[model samples]
Target chain A: MSEPTRGPKGRVEIKSEECKGCGTCVELCPQDVLLLGNDLNRMGYRAVTYKGDGCTGCGICFYACPEPGALSVYKIKDKALA
Target chain B: MARDTFTKAECLYDRYVRKTKVEPDQVSTHYCPGCGHGNVHKFVAETIDEMGLQDRTIFISPVGCSVFGYYYFHLSNVQAAHGRAPAVATALKRAHPNSIVISYQGDGDLAGIGGNEMLHAANRGEPVTMIFINNAIYGMTGGQMAPTTLLGMKTATTPAGRTARNEGGPIRVVELLSKLDGPVYLERVALTDAKQIYRARAAVRKAIQNQVENRGFSLVEILAPCPTGWKMDPVDARHWIEETMMQVFPLGVTCDRTKEIAPSEAKPVPFVHTDLRALLDIEDESEGFAPNRTHSEGVERGVRLKVAGFGGQGILLLGQGLAECGMGDGYEVSWLPSYGPEMRGGTAHCHVRISERPIGSPLVAESDVLIAMNRPSLERFLPDLVPGGTVLYDSSLIPDGVARSDVRAVAIPATQIANELGSPRTANMVMAGAFARATELFTVDHLKASLPRFVKAKATLAVNETAIDRGAAHMEKLLETVMT
Candidate 1:
């Protein structure tokens, strides 16, 4: 509905191999940005990459990442690009 | 709220036991000889009484030595599963948001089998408080080797002085759980001394206040003495807890969440009861999984992978980095850990399953891709490959170009590539880069967003950012060299 907040604060990073293909992230993303990736990664979790813009920095993504080290957020920086 | 002074300065027993004064009355505590559970309970009850929340609070008792907590605590409470007190607290925190729930668990209960749940609950920032007693031995279970047992300490299980080679090292639970973000308050105190007990009571008071003000998860781990198990006198027991356990689990607030997140300003967050029937789409048990967009919308490209390697191969993070890309792709997923004792010496293997379907188990039976980080793993798991699977092995590690028939094979000098790039650790990233080239697993754009998740918070912000780019390029060279 809105332009996705691409800032790293509230994003989810999927560790492709650790994914068990549970589709938990796809069903749970409130912003609906995470989806399974292509058949290219070593472990095909339909690894989650973004679809379009629409993420808030809310940590729902971080919570739902059951893979522990599989998914987590990074630092948010103030850049001129934004 | 100010600490209002009362005219009578009585002991904890009189003020909190449904009585007007502080002394032993109808409630007979079942603590062992020289056990610290009684003192810890006294401090907690007194704190509750002082706060005037005797009616508004709920107590949760653990299975170990503190099992008979209902005998003394004059409040609504239930005995929970061994090491599962955190789960009960989590449920209560979610259901009864306003109630102040306290979980009083022992070292055997909180730091052993229930270790993961405790860390996760703290990480979730549940509006609850926990009192973890670290006595170093399973007091209720006749002095077994608890997770917090001191190194080289003799126990029922570790008769030979708890060898580092056999039992491994003791887990520092407080320091480990502090890395998470959910806790509003965390402090580890020792009750072995008069000074420390007083300090512990104050910390407990602060933690309870945080809860009353609706602050999220507060944990206070106390190093209490067990004279009977340690085969020492009361004074000696306190001395042991102070000398041995304190060196490992230093007493202090791991995260002073009270300062960062004030509870007075806390409002009751909206609570949503999970609709399991609808979410599971369980019209009937016979139809196992509904194959529709409702449940199976994420992880379109289902890939189950197994990585095998040795300890020095830098292979553990291989599965993790790949899992990040999947998250970047907006896929539904889970990453399971596959580590065991064999990993300590020579061999290590991790099986990861990534898919669009609801995962029944974290264990991956067959793999779509197998990246053997070392020779031993290649020998161990070569036969377990699924049909039409792919193999990315280190050219230097593969013995006979094995599994070229059953699985599509590619050999890359991944570790060499990393050494050439000036970092041996990037070997795994280089392998990921090779997989990226051959598999088209995820676009570089998505992978770009996912790399930062593994960077440590204190620093590595800049090095990690630079490492990701370098990692991507090294594998890109492999793709270019191979394609030509």
Candidate 2:
């Protein structure tokens, strides 16, 4: 789980099982925070992953992602996770 | 403490249960990775959520890759035949004027096979939102050249390259539709990048909002990426749309009459005829004769009758009279007619079912009674008669009677009797009279009373009634001899 507790303005979660390694989200992410991981999901395709920090929560990646359930972008209201 | 705001749309199902047969994953769509359909689906779903149209929305999915759109969208879904989404959407919008109807179709489906349907539906100014995904190539059918395929574009069908002379130029659907006076809003957008996708999202919202306002037909043609079909990665496919596809299909609003046009009034409720007698122009005769509730002994299950003859022999009329008589007697009835091409000379047949209980199907594959007016009809339908069933034939026309001994064969010279009664067309009434008496399903008087409902000419009614009485008398005489 790549959770950003280091007080980033936002967080992005990538559901690995539903991702198909299309890299549309990775390429379109303005913060360059998303990447295709080496590990393969159950479907035998590399799934996208969050790079631990630096998510602006612009949600461009979410719109770019083709899979409806693969990406979730959240805007954190507070400085850090409680 | 931090509270996170979720950005995903709620209109999409949490789990796509309908897609279980295609793949094990419930969350994933059947579209290939980076397919433009997924992005468009997201936009539409989010718009539906934002507008609060989830409950009132009816989505018409076209044939092609997105045929399984019903599997993803949680709204009311209707899957149309290939290229027929516009037709379905028009009907849905007309029937449910308050509901938001959206027709989502692809390039090949909308512009190719269903071109005529889409054209006429839009021309009719039906207040329905249509999402036209123009990916340039037929993605679902394995990269075939679509009507919107750009010139010199290499596809499975156009392996070498698409040429203007050979395949003709790509169709700019939005531009073509802009020529029409019907559509209130028309825009062509792309899904090449975040900025273009945002434009597409806005266009989709506006198109749907136009329908919500009842401003008439609105279409958003989205230039979507087809990575798998284009043989490019997802990112490269997006770049290709921006760098190449936009040259052929420019992104812009071709028409915007939404602000000018007033919201259309709700369509009138489809006319229904509750008073069938008034609709059929028949006088109220039900009070004269009460419905006979007494059903025949063996016919408690139902009576399935098959009537067959030449088209001119009034075979269908005979069947209709039986069905109408059954209805008059308070029994559930169905009459289905099957006829060939020619109006008079071709073969004709009808299946009639009347029952004390509700009938399941109108088709009488194995009939309890076979009414044959010609020799061929008797020979063709003889095998389909149930064992110990009754066979009624026109003895004047069919000289060689039914060969089957398992069934009671009653030979009535129906045509000869009709000719004696002064008209040859009343032969069907004679057969109807025989049927009523032979089965004991209804009285001969009931059969005569129902004739005015079907018989149009008033002058021929007397002859038809006379033929029916004569046929019933002949059958009665035959039954008496058997009893003796």
Candidate 3:
């Protein structure tokens, strides 16, 4: 059984249902953090999967996705604030 | 459970599909994959949202790729005719003085076909913001040659590649518009990369801020990508804009006068009944003559008259006098003038409608009366005269007889009589007098009352007054002879 996991800086999360499987984000990722999955969504297109580590939260994938909500990078702030 | 971090764009609609669309399940736009319009639309929406102008904003979407702005913006939107966004935005801003209006246009829509409209609007300092997307080609029309097409760029229209010897050089719009004194802010920006996109977002916000602050005309020219039109991939198109288009259209704030120009505080024009009445100088019916009472003799319809002559022949003044006198007599009146481009010796005509009730249109398609001040005018307007209409022509100038047998015609030597009264310029006034006498629609006293109001010079007014009298006497003598 797989459990929810976190990466060092942040992880790239893809809305698998909304992805068009264009592979633009996979091709553009400098750290090789994303790849087109073998499985297809209900729309009959392959969804992108994260490589589970090495994401820098650069936001390049978010900008490159034609679909606005297809991808987002979430990071936890280091210092605690009031 | 990947922690619900990935989310939709803050500016985008909940669903990508327009609410008014018939296909409810559709959640996408008709724009090509990775089209720059989607990015630009997001920027505009974010600006409107951040500035709290969503409720008061009006987006004028022009023809071209940006015509569907209403489908996405989720604000008040109006679709303008091709290349007419600036003109439409100018009127919308003026009409709703408090609302923030934006003109969204593309290269072909703005610079190529709507150049004059954009130029005049900016020159006049219209208080509106404009978003110009320059993608170097006409994207909506299958990539036609645009005014901003690169020198060697090949488009649908320029199949052999744009050449300086034929297609001329691309236009630099931001720099060109910066020369104008009206615009308060002008900037050229790009969406090439994340850094450039951030800068473009600032420019977009500044442009909308200018309108919200009522500063004056503001424009942000955005160098956007058109991958499909450019025959390149989305990533390559972004690179092309940075590498190629940047060489032609440099990105920067071309002009910024926001600090110098103060915000406008003018109030919106009032459309209340009392205000309109005072503005138009419409007298109360009870305080003046009840003109429709005279038509108890059953003159059921309105009197539509067409007056035509050369530009300097007082044709418009003659029509104005009729409309003014009709208004004085408590009748609803309208006067519309048409003239040629030449200032003098140009063809001039006016339609005057005097109605007991409200006038439907100022245009007289089938005139009940035709006043031809010259031979050319008589021939020109003869076809528009209705059967049984009255034809009054200047006998001194027109040598031909009336051609229509069904109408009552009278040829008055109006110019000759005015010359005897010491001025040939009062011929139109003389004709006005003949109109009063022959039709008895308005009395000679009404004509006398309206004449003094229009003619400023004392001597000229006195001569015109005498000409009116003599002209009326001539028409009456003709009527008497016909009766005997």
List the candidates' TM-scores in order: 0.46, 0.88, 0.82
After superposition, the stretches of candidate 3 with alpha carbons farther than 4 Å from their true spots are A1-60, A66-82, B1-24, B123-127, B214-216, B256-301, B341-347, B481-484
B-chain TM-score for every candidate: 0.53, 0.89, 0.85
Of all native A–B interface contacts, model 2 reproduces a fraction of 0.70
RMSD of every prediction: 26.6, 4.0, 5.1
True contacts kept of each: 0.00, 0.70, 0.22
> Compared with the true structure, what per-residue lDDT tens digits does model 3 show for residues B1-484?
1232434545455664664567565455556755777667766776777678778888889899878776666788899999998999988887899898989999999999999999999999898899999999999999999999999899999999999899899999889989998888999998777677768878888898888778888999999888889998766888899999999999998889999977666467666888777775554644444545344455564589999988888899999988888777778899999999877797899999988778888889999999998888999998899999999999999977778899888999988998888788889998999988987877987888777556768767778888888888999999999999
The candidate maximizing DockQ is 2
Please provide, for model 1 over B1-484, each residue's C-alpha lDDT reduced to its tens digit, 9 standing for 90 to 100: 2221211112233223433264434323445445677667767776777778777678999999888776667787879998898999888877777778899999889989788779888888878889988888899888999988878999998887776788878877778878888887889898654457668878888888888888678888888878778888655676777777788878887888577765464344564444565574444533322233233345456678787787656466767767656644544456776666664556666767656566677677777888897777887777778877888888765646765586787777776766765666566766766666566656654554556555335253443334445546655776687679
Better of 1 and 3 by TM-score: 3
**How far in Å is the alpha carbon of B193 misplaced in model 3?**
2.2
Lowest-sum lDDT 10-residue window in model 2 chain B: B1-10
Docking class of 1: incorrect
lDDT of 1 by residue, A1-82 (tens): 3433443333345556545444444655666777867764543334566663455445444433333334554333443343
Pairs in clash, predicted candidate 2: none
Q: Which candidate is the best by lDDT?
A: 2
Clashes of 1: 49
